[model samples]
Structures are given as structure tokens and as C-alpha cells.
Target chain A: MTHASLALESALRQVAAEIDAQFDRLLDVPDDPRADLYRAMRHAAIGGGKRLRPLLVFATAQLFAVDKSCAARVATALECIHVYSLIHDDLPAMDDDDLRRGKPTVHKAFDEATAILAGDCLHDLAFELLAHEATHADPFVRVELISELARSSGPAGMAGGQMMDLEAEKASFDLATVTRLQALKTGALISCAVECGAILGRVPHEGRTGLRGYARDIGLAFQIVDDILDAEGDEALVGKKLGKDGAAGKETFLSLLGIDRAREQARMLVDQAIAHLHAFGPEADLLRDVARFTLERDR
Target chain B: MTHASLALESALRQVAAEIDAQFDRLLDVPDDPRADLYRAMRHAAIGGGKRLRPLLVFATAQLFAVDKSCAARVATALECIHVYSLIHDDLPAMDDDDLRRGKPTVHKAFDEATAILAGDCLHDLAFELLAHEATHADPFVRVELISELARSSGPAGMAGGQMMDLEAEKASFDLATVTRLQALKTGALISCAVECGAILGRVPHEGRTGLRGYARDIGLAFQIVDDILDAEGDEALVGKKLGKDGAAGKETFLSLLGIDRAREQARMLVDQAIAHLHAFGPEADLLRDVARFTLERDR
Candidate 1:
């Protein structure tokens, strides 16, 4: 791997560790009857996957010299939200996936009731973490983080996107419709992660605009790569089912634009995403590297 | 009806109308592909229940001279949370009820997937409302409201209580255990409604203590009456299945204390609740009347 790629991998690992520890501390199973619920939550949240959302939070927060400790809490909350979404999305009533990250999905490992409750609890925990004083010393900044996260996760955002995706299975969708679907389904939270860091560091309005541009580009690039990976990458490496999108006849970026065009578009987005950070120096090296990594990662 | 009872009834009707109208305005089904999800959310939230939680919020906010407009927003959010809980709780995996407030449950009305997504979206909407500037002018107060609501709804609160209740069906539980379960499952949100109003009005710490006491008493009394109605009230009037608790052999206050004793306990708790509000005068008459109504409500 190149030096930049190695650095991104190390940073990702560090943030993953930080998030895992936080979840451990935040969700220690008590010696009570609810221990099973807590265990289900831990099973869903703690075990696996690339911690890309939290990495974005950390990398963006680093751009403003924000403390890692404060950023860690936000990262942890965002991951909780991300994981909860995955848990719910994999439910029998939703995707009906039995496998996640090469292991049994929460509903498969636990009961469907426990899986639902665990997802519900984690969603609550995410907001609770942000509302706590520990997230930021300034209450206004904390509220801003919450406001952005909520908007990104709510009906007009991630949930809305999911609803759209569920409907998409019934009929064909155009490129623009698909783009908007990815933006809300996946882009909103990614953009929120970047914006949250800026809120924490008190980035100026113009600087935030630039960061948002970077976030938007990388968010799309990330989804494009995701589609490419699902279409072509190894299932064992992906750690879940692959080609299901194509099998289900879902219109993904690759299906709409074809593999070569989709790969070209993702690379172009990564370059554009990197260009948005031209205002910063080496301070944003990790963010730049992450944008490039989005195009290359298999999972 | 007594004059106080008549006043309480009118006030309840008015607030219920206000909440229904607000939900209709807030959750208008967009002419989008996901309109079904929106419809499901509206079905769950718009046309149901006593609006008791919002009434508690309105009543409590009135004590501190909070603006009705601001209080209305909080009330809307609290009602959203309450309704979302009901939607999820009625899922086939949970309580599995087909009817709620004389209408088909969300999952029954829509598909289960839509019902789950609707509930998820409403939960997100509640926090989004709390984090919005319209909820409160002061960001700190908004954060506090979010924090309290998150805590009340999260694992250690509502969800945790639900886990315990799920476990309780398998094994017999004592009175104390049952009481704790009811407090966490039902009482937490009711108390949160009262506390949210106090937070909005900027009630002093000492003043909050009395309100908390009043809320705790009323919350318990409310649950006792629910148990009594479940055991004896007409299913038509109750608008849902009754005697399920007895059929399930779940230990409720009525099961433990018996009918006469449970009724007596509810009355005693209502008296104590009123005494806690003795510091206020006629301005708090609605709150006192509401507490009394808890013991007398048939549904």
C-alpha cells in the first residue's frame, strides 16, 4: 500500500478502537433481566465493519484542531446511529438478511423482538450521547450537532431514502432519482459527520461550505464504490451477500452507468472531493487520503 | 359531571384537537414515492388516544407561565414519541394488537414494513423537534429536553422496561418488580412530559422537585387505572382488547393488590399527587383535576 493508504488504514483502525471502547463503556451489560437486550445491542454495534463514518468525524475534527476525546463521543454516537440503521434495514420485515459482516444478523442471532428493541435502544443512545455535556463543553455546539444528526437521520433524510428504496423495487428509477436516493439514504449521514466536526471546531461559514462540498463528493463516491463492490467484489471480502442488488434488479450506479463508467465517475468524484480541501494544507491529508481510499476499498 | 370534571374534559378535548391539527400539518403526505410510509406515520400519530401526555405537558407548562405556542411544539413532540412507542409496541413481535383506539394498528392498516418504518421515522421526528429552535429559544434548554427525552426512551428507561416486561411473561414477578417495570415502561414518558414543560418554563430546581413528585404520583395512578380498566372495562369503550394481561398471567397492580386494593391505592396516589401541587393555586387547577381524572378515566 502507498503511504497515504497506509495512513488512512491506521486512522480507521484507531477510530474503530475508540468507538469500540466507548460502546463497551457506554453499554456494559448489567446483571439484570435486560442484560440480553444489552447483549443484542452490543452484538449489533460492537463487532465489525469499517468505521468510515466515525473516521470522517475524526478526520474532519482534526482539521480544526478539535480534541479527539470530544470527537470520540460524537463518533461513537454516529456509529450507533449507523449500526442501528443497519440492524433495522436487515430485519425480516425489511431486507430479511440473515447474514451481516459474515455473522448472523442481530435478528438471526437474537429474536426479532430483541433485535427491534436493540435497534430502538441504540437510536436513543446516539441522541443521548450527543445531548450529554461530555459531547461538547458548549451547549450550543452540542445542540447543533444533534440538530444536524437528527435532520440527516429523520424522515426527509436516511429514513426517507430507505422508504424510497423500498418503493424503488416495484419499478424502474432514473439516474437523478437514484442519485437523490443515495444522497438521502447514505449521503446525508456522511455529510452530517463532516459537518458535525466543523460544528465542533467552530469552522467559519465559508469553510463549512467548502467542507460540505468535500463531504458531498466523497459521499457519492463512497456509494458508487459500494455499488461496484457489491457487483464485482468477493462476498467473503465484502463480509455479506453481494450481487443481491443486481439479483433483485435494483438500479445501482453500476447497473445504470455500467462498471467502467461507474468506476470512472467514482475516481472523478474522489479527485473533486480532494480539490474541495485545497484551502487547507497537510492538516487535511487524512481527509484527502480517505477520499482516494473510498474508490479503492473493497468493502 | 362536577365543574372540575367538566373543565378537565373540555381542556382535554381542546388539546386533543390542537395535537391532531398539528400532526396533520407537520406530517402531510408528500407527493413522493414514499407516500405510503408517510401515510403509515400519519395513521399512527394523527387519529388516536386521549392525548393525555400532551395534556400533561400543556398543564405543567401552564404552571410556569410558558407560552402556549412553545408549549404546543413540545407537546407535539411528546405525543409523537408516545405514538411511536405505541406503534412499535403493537407490532406482531411485540404486543401484536390488531386494534388501537378502535382503529386498525399501523402494521395492520399498512404493511408491517411500512409500520416499522413509520414508527422509526416518528421517533426520529420527535428528537428532531426537540433539537429544533422552535422548541425553545435557549439551546441549553433544548439540549436538556433532548437529553431527558432520550434518557426516558432509551435502554435504561422505556426500552429497558420493555425488555423486562418481555422477560416477565415467562416467569412470575413480585409487586416491586412489576412496579418498576410499569414505572419504566409507562411512567418514564409521562414524567418526561411534565419535566419537559418545566424545562421549557425554566422552573427552578426546587420547584421541579415538587412537580416531579406530582408527576410520579399521577404516573403510577394512571397505570393502576389502566390495569383496572383492562381487567374490567368494556372492550368497546376501551377500544382495544381487554383482559389480555389476565390471559397472559402477567402480574399487574390489579393482579397483585386485587381490584378493591388497587382502586384504593390509585385514589391515595391521586390525593398525594394533588397535595404535592398544593403550593400552586387555581392556576394549577387543571393539573390537579387531571390527576383526579387519572383515577376516573375509563379508557
Candidate 2:
């Protein structure tokens, strides 16, 4: 790897480590008799992979030279939301996957009831962390962050997309329907990460739109690549049972457009996403690397 | 019904109708694209319960002679939380019940993924309603309401209680364990309702504590009576399949202490719950009636 690549990788490695450590501290099982609840929540949340969401926060904040500590709490909060969604998605009623990240799914490692409540707890913890006065953003900004994240994850966004995907399963969906679903289910949080990064960086208004567009384009590209990988990727590398989406009759980009077409679309989107970073000058090279990394990363 | 009973029933019925209508008005179903999500969310939320939470809010506000509009939005918000919890609890991975209030559960009526997303969306709508400064209480009060409800429902509260209860199954829980579990799972929301009522009513701190105590005791009694009824009541009257708790090795007061002793304990709790209402003098008569209703209601 080149120096910048190593710098980006090293930065991401540090992000993963810091997020894991902070999460561990934040979610330590209390000695209360009801500590099982805490433990289940902790188990569901801690020791995740690349910490992609927090990395986005850090990288976005770095573009404007914002202090890392200033972004830490919200970074943790973003992970909380992501983790909660994963737990819920793995429940027996949903994907019913017994494994996640090559480990037992929360419901499998714990019990279904505990997994359900743990997910529920994590959802609230995200908002609770945001609600804290100590987070110290302007009140309106806090409200905006809370509201935006809530909308992105709630029915109109991620949840809604999941519902649409479930409803459209195995039925020949058009490219538009597939793209719309992917945008909501996968892209919403990714876009939120970039938007939040911009928020933390206090990016000027015109620059803010550019950053958001960059995030959106890359986020959608990321999902398209994910769909491509699901069709062709190795199980050991992805750390998940491959092609389960196909087996489940789920709707995905590759399922709708084929691998070649999906790859083409991803390339196009990456180009557009990178274009948005041009106004940032050299300071956004890391972001440009991230856009490329999003499409190129194997796992 | 006697005159007082008739009056209370009619008033509560109106409160329920008004709350539903108000919620219906607040919901905006976007055209075509996202309309299905809005529709599913409305379907899940609009058709449930006697609106006891909202009734409590309205009644408690009445106790302070607060204007009806002052607490109306909160009344709706509380019901939103209650509805969301029920939707989630009835999911196939959770209680897996087919029936609730004499009709199919959301998961049974809809698909599992839709049910899950519907619950999640409902949760967001609840907070969104609270965040709307135009709708109800002041910002500070609204923030407090949001914080309290979030805390009550998350870990260390309702969800925690559910986790403990899940574990309590297959084990012989003592009275203390049973009580603690109920307090968190069932009692927290009930207590929050009464406390919220008082808060919206602008009741003094002492009154808030007194109402909270009343709610807690009555809530516990409500669970005890539910246990006793489940042991002896007809499934037709209960409006759902019954006896699964025993089959699942779930712990309940009647299961632990026998029906007769459980009934005795419930009556004692009702008395204590009523005693706490004395702090509000004659204005709290409705709360006392509700306490008695907890132990005496046929359903």
C-alpha cells in the first residue's frame, strides 16, 4: 500500500479499536441483579469490524480539522444505531441468520427474547446518548441530528426499505424499485454518516451540499458492490453464508441487473461521488480514497 | 353501569376516539413511493386498546384543571409508545401470539418484517410528535417527556424487565423476583403514564411522587390480577389464546403463590395503590377507581 493508503488504513484501524474500547466501556455489564440485560446489550454491540460509521465521522470531521474528541460521542451513537439494526435484522422472524460477522447472531448467542430487548435497548441508548446535554452541540443541532437519524432509520427510511424489499421478494422488480429499496435499506445510514460528518465539521452551506451528494453517491455504490459481492464473493472472506439473499428470494441489485450491469452502475456512481469532492481541494483526498475504498473493499 | 361508572366510561371512550382521530390527522401518507410505509404504520397503531394511557394523561391534566389542548399531543404520544411495544411483543420472534384485543396481531395480520418496521416507525413517530413544539407542551417539558419515556422503555426499565421475565421462565422465581421483573417490564410505562399526566398537569413534585407511587402499586396489582385471571379465565373473555405462560414455564404470581394467595396480594396492592392517591384529595378519585378496576376488571 502507498503511504496515503496506509494512513487511511491505519486511521480506520485506530477507529475500529477506539470504537470497540469506548463501546466496551459504555456497555460494561453492571453488577445489578438484572445485569443479564446489560450483558446481552453489550454482547450485541461490542467488537464489530471496521467501525465504518465512526470512521466516516472521523474522516468527515478531519476534512474541516474538527477535533476527534468532538466527534467521538456521536460516532459511538452512530454505531449504536447500526448495531441495533443488525440485531433486529438477525432475529428469527427476520433473516433468521444464526451467525453475524462469523459469530453467533445475538439471538443465537443469547435467547430470542433477550436479543429482541437488547436491540430495543440499543435503539434507545442511541437517542439517549444524543439527548445528553454533555454532548454539547447546539440544542437545535442536537434536535436536528436526532430527528435526521430517526427519520433515516425509522419507517420512512431503513425500516421502510426493508419492508419494501420483503414485499418485493422474488417478484421481478424493476431497476427503479430495486434501486429505491437499496437506497433506503443500505444507503440511508451511509448518507447520514456523511451528513453528520459535515454537521460535525461545521461545513459551510455550499460545501455541505457537496459533501452530502458525495456521501449519497458513494453510499448507493457501496450497496451495489455489496449486492455484487453477495453473488460472487467468498464465504470465508465475507464472514457470512454467501448467496443467502438469493436463497431467501430477496430483491437485490445483482438479482435485478446482473453482476456486469451492477458493476457498471457502481463505477458510474463512484465517478459522480468523487466529483462532489473536487471543491474540497487536497484536504478531501482521504474522502476520495474512502469513496474508492467503499466500492473496492472485499468484505 | 352505575351513573359514575357510565360517566367515566363515556368520557374515556371519547378520549380514546379523540386521540385516534388526532393521530390520524398528524399522519401524512406521501404519494406512491413511501405511501405503503405510512399506511402500514397507521394500520398498526390506529386500531388498538381502550387508550388507557391517553385517558390517564387527559384525566391527570383534568385533575389540575389544565386546558385540554395542553396535554392532548402527549396523550397521543403515550399511546404511540404503548402501541409500538404491543406490535413488537407480538412478533413471531417474541411472544408470537396471533391474537390481541380479539384480532390478529400485527405480524399475523401483516408480514413479520412489516410488523417489525411498523413498530420501529411507530416509535419514531412518537418521538417526532413530542418534538413538535407546536403540538403540545413546552420544549423543556417535551424534552423531559421524551427522556423519561426513553429511559422507562429502554434497558434498566421495560426492556430490562422483559429480559428478566424471559429468564424467569423455566425457573421458580420468588415473590421478590416476580415483583422486580413486573416493576421494570410492566410497571415502568404505567408509572410513566401517571407521572406524565402529572407533569403535563404541572403538578408539584410531591404530587408527582405520590402519583408515581400510585401508578407503580396499581401497575403491579394489575399484573397480579392478570396472572390470576390467566389461571382461571376463559380464553373467549380474554380475547386471546391463553395458558401458554404456564406451558412455557413462565413465572407469575398465581403460578408461584397459587391463585387464592395471588388474589389476596392483588387486593392488598390495590389498597396501597389507592392510598397514594390521597395526596391529591378528591381530584384523584378517578385514579382510585382505575386502581380498583385493575383488580376487578373481568377482562
Candidate 3:
């Protein structure tokens, strides 16, 4: 394996371990009637995934020389948002998927009602984690983090993207429309992860321009690669049912550009994403490596 | 009408109008494909209700000489949380209710998937509103508001209460368990509306104890009256299906104590709630009126 691939693998594992421990500590179910709900939340949050968003948070925070504990809190909050979205998206009325991260989805493992409440509770807890003093010493920073996360994850962000995706399944979308949908659905949260780390590190507006650029490029690449995987990748390795987009006739980068062109586009975006980090020295090596890994990752 | 009731009536009308307008402005569906999701959010948020939580926020903030705009924003945020909860609770998997506020529930008006997304988006927008500068001049106050709202609405609060209530359907609950369930499910967000107003007003910790006590008493009384309404209220006036708790054999205050005793308990709680404000003068007259209104309100 290349040095960057090895480094990326090690960093991903480290952040995943840190975030898992944080979620376990944060999501302890009390011995009460609501223990079931707590258990459901724990099942959804603490259970496995790539932990890519949290890794971005930790990696970007490292660039700013931010403390590990603070980054862990932010990463955990981001993961909560991501997990809640997945749980909701898997509902019978939504994607209706029975599997997530290679296990029964929340609604499948628990009851649908429990799954809905657990998702709602997890969403609330994400903000709670960000608002805590332990997340950051400065109230301004905490509020900023909350604002950015909320915006990115709200109507014009992930939810909006999902809505667009639902519409896309019914109608063929052009390249621009598909790009916008991908940007909102998956790109927004990914960008927020990086921006949050930058915020925690007190990266100024000028410094953030490059990071934002990096996030945008990688965000699209991430989604394009996702489209590629959904079309052709192994379901076991992907940890989810693949080819659903094609089955549903959903317009994705892969549908719009075909696999070969989509692959070329993702590679171009990753290179451009890496270019954005050129202004930083070796401090952004992990981010650069992660950008490359996005194209190479099977899941 | 008595002077206090008349004053509260006017204040409620004014704030409800203000909040309705604010929600309309904030929830505008852009001219895009995701406009349907935005429409669902608008329908859930702007549709008819008592706007009681927003009224509490405005009334409590009035005591602190806080700006009306700031209070309005906080009130709007609180309303978002309240409406989001209602949307989720009315889901087919949860309460399976078709009606809310004299209109079709969000899921009925839109679809179940849209309803879930709308609720999720509103939940995010609540934090976004609280974190905005328009919510407060002080970032510390905003962070505190976010933290308090998150805690009140999360696992240990509203979500936990809902879980307990769901469990109550399967097994009988005693008076204490019922009270605890009501406190977490309904009381937390109601109390949060008052507490957030106090925070924006910069109420001292000592000053807040009375408010907290007042909130706790009123919260119980609010739920007791809800039980009473479910058992006795006109379906049209109540604006939703009634007696579902009894139908589901869910344990409630009315079920535990009978109608007469439950009404008596609610009255006693209301009087006690009023007693918490004895230290303040007529500035608290509106709060006292609201506590009384909780019992007298048919819907």
C-alpha cells in the first residue's frame, strides 16, 4: 500500500475508535422505561459506519492545532447528524432499506416508532453536544459551530438534497441539477465537517476560502464515487445495498456521465481538492490523502 | 373578560401574529425542485395552533425588558421545536393521527416521507434560529438557550417522555410514573419556552428559581388539563382526534385519579403555579393569567 493510503487507514481507524468511545459515554441508557429508546439511539449511533465526517473534523482540526477532545465532541455531533439522517432515510416511507452498515436498520432492529423517536432524539443530542462548554471554551465558537451545522443539515442542505433525490427518481435531471442535488444531499455535511474543524482552530475567513474550496471539490468527488459504487461496487464491501439508484432510475453522476466519465470526473475533483491544500505545507497531508482515498474507497 | 385575561388575550393575538409572519418569512419555499419539502415545513409550522409556547417566551421576556424582536426569534425557535414534535408524533407509525389543528396532518397533506423530512428540517431550523444574532445580543445567552433547548427536547426530556408514554400503552403506570412521563414528554419544551425567555432577559440564577418552580407547576397542570380535554373536549374544538390515550389504554392522570380528582388536581397545581410568582408584582400578572388559562382552555 502507498504511504498515503496507509496513513489514511490508520487515521480513519483512530478517529473511528475515538468517536465510538465518545458515543458510548454520551449515549448511556438509564435503567428506566425509556431504556428502549436509549438502546435504539445507542444502536443507531454507536454501531458501525465509515466515520468519514468525523475523520474530516479531526483532520481539519489538526491543521488548526486544536485539541483532540474538542475535535472529538464536534466529530461525535457530526456523526449523530449523519446517523440520524440515515435512520430516517431508511424508514419504510423513505428508502425502505432493511440494512445499514451491514446490519438491520434502526426501524428494522427496533420498531418503526422507536426508530423515529431515536432518530429525533439523536438529532437533538447532536446540538446538545455542540452547545456544551466542553465542545469549545468560547461561546462564540460554539454558536458558530451550531449555526453552521444546522444550516448545512437543514432545509437547504442534507434534507433538501434528499428531497431533490426523491424528485430525481421520478424525472431525469441534467448534470447541473444532479450536481446541485449531490452538493446538498451529501456535500453540505461533508463541507460542514471540515469547516467546523477550521472554526475550532480559529481559521480566519481568508484561510477558510481554501478549505471551503477543498471541501466543495471533494464533496462532489465523494458523491460521484458514491454513484459509482452504487452502480457497480460489491454490496458486502459497501455495507449497503448497491445499484438502488440505477434500479430506481435516479439521476446520478454515474447515470448522467457513465462509469468511465464519472470516474474521470471524480479523479479530476480529487486532484483539484488536493490542489486547494497546496497553500498549507505538510499540515494538510491527511486531508490530501483522504481526498485520494475517496476515489479509491469501495464503500 | 377580567383585566388579566383581556391583556393576555391581546398579547397572545399579537405574538401569534408576529410568529406566524416570522415563520412565513423563514419558511418560504424557494423556486426549486425541493420546494415541496419547504411547503411541507411551512404547512406544519404555519398551520393553526394556540401558539402557547411562543406566548410564554414573549411574556417571560417582557419581564426582563428584552427586545421584542429577540423574544420573537426565540419564541419562533421554540415554536419550531413544538411543531416538529407534533409532526413526528402524528406520524402513522407513532400516533397515526389524521388531523392536527383543524387540518390534515403533515403526512396527510404531503406524504409520510415529506412529513419526516419537514419535521427533521424544522428541528434543525430551531437550533439555527437560536444560534443567530437575532435571538440575542450575547453569544453566551444564545449558547445557553441552545443547550437548554437541546437538553429539554432530547432523550432525557421530550423523547424519553414519548418513549415512556409509548411503553405505557403496553403496561399500566402509576400516578408518579404518569407524572414523570408527562413532565418529560410535554413539560420539558413548555418549560423550555419560559426558560429561554428568562435566559434572553438575563435573569439572575436566584431570580430563575421562581421561574423554574413556576414552570414545573404549570407544566404538570398543562398535561393534566390535556388529559381532561382528551376525555371531555369537543372534537372540533380540540382540533384533533381525542381519547386516543384511553383507547390505547395508556395510563394518564385522568385514568389514575378519575375526572373529578384530575380536574381538582389540575386546579390545585394551577393555584400553586400562581403562588410561585408572588414575589413579583403585576409584571407577572400575564404569567398568572396563562396558568389559569391552561385549566380553562378547552383546546
Task: Highest DockQ: give the candidate number.
Answer: 3
Q: How far does residue B113 in candidate 2 sit from its true spot (Å)? A: 2.7
Which DockQ-derived CAPRI band holds candidate 3?
high
Candidate 1 vs candidate 2: which has greater TM-score? 1
Distance from true location, Cα of B204 in model 1, Å: 2.5
Clash pairs (backbone) in predicted model 3: none
Q: lDDT, candidate 3, residue A195? A: 98
Candidate 2 segments exceeding 4 Å error: A1-4, A30-36, A62-70, A199-207, A248-251, A279-283, B1-4, B26-40, B63-70, B135-138, B199-207, B258-261, B281-283
- The per-prediction i-RMS, to one decimal, reads 0.8, 2.1, 0.6
**Sort by TM-score, top down from the best:** 3, 1, 2
Instruction: Give the winner by TM-score: 1 or 3.
Output: 3
Instruction: Report lDDT (CA) for all predictions.
Output: 0.89, 0.76, 0.91
Assign candidate 1 its CAPRI class: high
Q: Under CAPRI classification, how is model 2 graded?
A: acceptable
Question: After superposition, which runs of candidate 1 have C-alpha atoms over 4 Å from their true positions?
Answer: A1-4, B1-4
Q: Pick the candidate with the highest TM-score.
A: 3
Native contact recovery (fnat) for each candidate is 0.78, 0.48, 0.95
lDDT of 3 by residue, A1-299 (tens): 23348788899889878988998998888988998898898888875998999999999999989999999999999999999999999999999999899988999998999999999999999999999999999999999999999999998899999999888877889999999999999999999999999999998878798899999999999999998888888888788888899789887898789889999999999999999888899889999989988888877
TM-score against native, each model: 0.97, 0.90, 0.98
- DockQ for model 3 equals 0.92
